[model samples]
Target: MDRKHVLITGGVGGIGVELVRLFAQAAYRVSFTYRPGEESRQRAQALLDEVGEEGMHALELDVGDRQSHARLMDTLSLPLDIVIHNAGVGTKTVERAAATYKEQDEVFFRVNTLGPLWLSEDVIPGMLARGHGKILLMSSVDGGITHFPRFRAADGMSKAAVAFLGRQLAATYACTGIDVFTVCPGATDTPMFQASTLDALSAEQRRLLEASLPGGRLIAPREIADLCFYLCRDEARILRGAVIDASLGLGVCPAVMG
Candidate 1:
């Protein structure tokens, strides 16, 4: 049997890397996207090497760029059996007094919300033709299902739209063999999480934050990857359109952010 092909965006990122590795190990032909840059290029190459080259490929992509989305679709040789919209921008500390919110908010919406919309449009036709496909949209607790203060509102707004998008697609593709779902992860242990929320904190504050979490630690990228892998399986189609809270306990408790 031919291996199933999967395309994962932001493959150089913390969760993205784990997703790529898991899918590749499951005997899938993995095509993952990385932003075009020297650093991303090096990381992508390293991941490719680690996963072995035979069934793994890396493509340059800027999720926020429509032209990049077109270029990516044009470059694919395999019809995607699974597409994970994992690329996203992290929340920045909102500067309420500054006028920069509008500019920054545009970027959040473009990459986090619209990127998946555009790419799904391109891939869904192929999926429809084949009679089966899986799509996973990576969202977060904030704006995906719940909200926490001190973070940019745009970040949450963009992710909430992703949750809605997943449900809408699932409904549209119901019974057509296309399964769509959204995962809202909590404070995950990724560079983005560290930089956005933890890096500036003192040791005491960081410890307190960890203690507040359900597991007394950040959610591991591998945990999320495993969940995603299963969600794409044929059996998981029953969960179609579900907006899962992968947040442990943080989704219900905004106090954890303090």
Candidate 2:
């Protein structure tokens, strides 16, 4: 098949990097974003080097800056076929939120929620004009975006809002053959998982935590990536506006496996 352009935000981090690897290998012309300085740049380039730089492009971007999307629209020489909205961070903002919920709201919102919104808004219009495109919003399997419990107040609220954003956007544009998928992958083994709040627990506690899962372990990063690749295909475009969960089995872990 002919290669198409695919853009992934946060494409330097653990799961993000893996997604880059997967998409590039699948023969998509890939463009990705990174924000931190040289170290991150080095790592991303190294990964691409291992793959020989064909059908891959990486650049630094602040996804929070919606205005930049305008620049991308103007400067991009190629049409984008797939976009994976993966720029976000959470699960350890407890202390930060406690101290500055108001101040930090924009930070989290921009990176986690608005980034995708702006990207989708900018990209989908062009998609409608072309009558073909696939977009996926990378979310968490921690909870359904709607009907979030009270315990995970902030993260839940933000994710829920973004989920609605994705849903509404998909509904608005689905008629034009522009597809959108809300992707929720479970706790995948990556740097984010390594840096998780659960890391504070003892090894036994970690094992106990694993025991709570039906798989008795965390989800694999590659698993999420492969699923992402699946969703972005033209064939999977029919699944638009669907909440596709890459979770092992949430809220129903069988005791024997756990």
Candidate 3:
């Protein structure tokens, strides 16, 4: 079988990085986007080196900008078979819940929600025409069944909406051979968690938080990537609209983490 074409957004985050590496190593035409950061560029270069020039490419992409998808298509110069919507934000502007939803910044909606919709919609037509495509969504467990403390209504609603959008898209494009899989990973050991406002919790509070999870440890990015790798393949074509949790069996360990 020929290698597939794949694109990943937020391609340098911990999970995104592993996705890039896994797909590139699999010999897929791997492309990822970063929003103007040296660390992102350097990491892209390193991934390219690891993949060794078979079909790895990196581009500057601001997912919030709908026009960037057009630019991405122009830059890639090929039909995409797999698209991973991995660019997102899990942060909340306010510390507590309010009576009504309020906007904090344009970025929260633009990057986390609308951007994926824009990209997926733009690519769906092409996938329909070709009768082959795979779209993966990187949502969070907090957006699914689990509850988060100090959660923003926008983030939760947006991700849940994204998942629903994927499900609807799958139903709409079922006969076209496109699979829409939503991945919900919990408390990954990424920069997002480290930089989370909850990091300010007292030592005992933090321990209690860790104790809530079954594994007693944060989920690794690679585990999520491995699942994504499987999902991106043609073999996983039946996993449409499915939400896979890669949270290290969280919410179920007896022991607590320090």
Candidate 4:
């Protein structure tokens, strides 16, 4: 039997790293994409070195660039068993891109929504031919309008679209060997979470945010990673088209009313 292969986008990031580690340790040939630049290369190499060079590889990719996605898929030799679309910019970053809401929406939608859509479409044909594959999309609890405290219009719309895309793909591929699903995580503790998502909050704001969730704590990156790994297994086939919420009960409340 051939060695299973998995490709993950934004693999150098917090949750991405955990996902890469779990898959690589499971003996799968893992290939993950990082954005182009020296820092990204260094991050990717450092992680790959820890896993050893044999079955791990990293590529520079801008998931936001459709051309890059197409080029990478076209050049790949291995048939993938799993593909995790985990790359995304936080709402704060999107908000900071420009003063206008239209500008922010444009940037967020392109990266957060279109990136996954295009990349998945590019890879789906190969997966179909191979007759077995798993694709997991990383969305967020921000996708739910009523649950989150602050309304981030672009972020919510983009993530919601991703969730919709996953469901559509799963329905389209029903009964096939291929599987599609989305994982909606709440506030995960990661560098991105710290910098973009939480840095601006005051102590009181942070307290309220934590209290908003059932656990009253941030979700660990590894927790989501473990969930991603589990959902890709054969036993998880019945979960096709599902938007699995690993949100630490954040959505249990109807709204974050003060």
How many pairs of residues collide in each model? 0, 0, 2, 0
- Model 3's alpha-carbon lDDT is 0.74
Query: On residues 56-105, what C-alpha lDDT tens digit does candidate 1 reach at each position?
Result: 89999989889999899889876889999998887652232124878778
Candidate 2, run of 10 with poorest lDDT: 143-152
When superposed on Cα atoms, how far off is each prediction in RMSD? 2.5, 3.3, 4.3, 2.2
Q: Give me the candidate number with maximum lDDT.
A: 1
Order of models, best lDDT first: 1, 4, 3, 2
* Span of ten consecutive residues with least summed lDDT in model 1: 90-99
Off by over 4 Å in 2: 68-75, 93-99, 143-152, 251-258
Window of ten residues with lowest summed lDDT in model 3: 92-101
* Model 2, position 164: C-alpha lDDT score: 78
Q: TM-score of every model?
A: 0.95, 0.87, 0.85, 0.91
- Displacement of residue 61 (Cα, Å) in model 2 is 1.0
- Alpha-carbon deviation at 81 in model 3, angstroms: 1.2
Instruction: Judging by TM-score against the true structure, name the best candidate.
Output: 1
